[model samples]
Target: MRLKETEPEEIKLNMTAMIDIVFQLLVFFIMTFKVVAMEGDFNIRMPLASQNQEESMDEDFPTIIYVQLAAGTNGNINSIIVDDDTTFSDTDMYSKLTQLVESKIAAEGNPEDSKETEVEFDIARELKYSYTVKAIEAVSGKVVDGQIKKLIQKIKFKDSTSF
Candidate 1:
């Protein structure tokens, strides 16, 4: 007996289920999505050209104070030099620093004058971090009679390569 061969039928794919699954996934993601603010957004005001020019022409601008910290063999602060004139050792470093900073800005006679003054630190690369911090604290402020006295607000570090 001879067997008859049957032709193969075309397979049809149901797209409704696939479309539903895609729609479900899209809806889930949309429902779970959250809106967030961008980081580091700052509100800065730009000055006009005339104002900038006027400010630049002002001769009463404060001066820059240079403080150099030298390190010893043990990474400790060996000496503190201010403006190539005054030097304070580890024994009385902080007190002398505070006094020097106070005296420098004292001519202005206004506490706000300290804000106009800028301090640039030229610290040794090998100096101990603690000493660096202490030096910063010394010029930053002082506590007098149970009250905090604000000092120079503008502080910056000089490049180590320049030392």
Candidate 2:
């Protein structure tokens, strides 16, 4: 008998299948995955309308301002915030926001423009929903909804916070 060779055969891994799976998984995630913000304390119980409608409606518009409302420790809406720190209330709130809106319109250099941008509100979740609506209505003569068409001409209910 011939002398036996002790060398072992080399093993190889087929990466093409693994690479194809990885690429497939990547594409699958790209199609299925979505990125969204987490509104931890901020929440709203938006009611679902029973009326079935087309999905393409209200798809192109962009909102302007964002208003955040939270319940103060005293159980009253002691402050109204913008973005985060821009807080105001009473006359101050009205004046500041009004000025901000006015300035925004002015920035476009349109003196006779009646179009209003959106004002998203993050209000105290515990407060009666009417209270929040009333606050904005008191200012814009309407409630914030998509397009701000009714009372709030350019408003959107951004979110609400429990605290």
Candidate 3:
């Protein structure tokens, strides 16, 4: 019996199409990428609750100013109230808020008071987000002679459902 010998054929995969697909995917992802701006810089410090009630009720405790942002029917800021007394509903609400915050800081009679002061924002659920941000900016700080003068460093948000 006679046997026939056969040679094995080399198998070559066409990688050009695979490389093209990889480049296309890279280009698509690059084109669809988006850049977003940075968020606001806020410094907040919350200490643990005191076990002693007397210490919590101390007279030297840090001052907490409440800011109430009431919204109108149109979701616009109707009034900006500070401590349930001072209210600003004029067109320049933000400026008034900034001034009030600044005055409060100055009234402490010490430059170090700004760090100890805290602002609690009680914003209406219907208020526009922009208005809330403006109010925050007003109390956060102000630009003085091209320099930023930091005001109250601590900020907190109250329960909206309570309003």
TM per prediction: 0.60, 0.44, 0.66
Question: Deviation in angstroms for 140 in model 2?
Answer: 1.2
Model 2, 1-163: lDDT tens per residue?
A: 9998889978998899999999999999999998988743222333333221232154445335667666756556666677665777674565465555556555756534434345667667676664575556544532246453232354545432211
**Window of ten residues with lowest summed lDDT in model 2:** 47-56
lDDT per residue (tens digit) for residues 1-163 in model 1: 9989989999999999999999999999999999998764212234455664587587565678999999999998899999999999869888899999999899768766687787889999999998987887788888999997878766667752211
Clash count in backbone of candidate 1: 0
Which one is best on TM-score? 3
Segments of candidate 1 deviating more than 4 angstroms: 1-61, 160-163
Tell me, by lDDT, which candidate is best: 3
TM-score between model 2 and native: 0.44
- Give the candidate order by descending lDDT: 3, 1, 2
- How do the residues 86-128 of candidate 3 rate in per-residue lDDT, one tens digit apiece? 9999999899999998888889889676887878899899899
Q: Which stretches of candidate 2 lie over 4 Å from their true place?
A: 1-60, 89-91, 111-116, 128-134, 138-152, 159-163
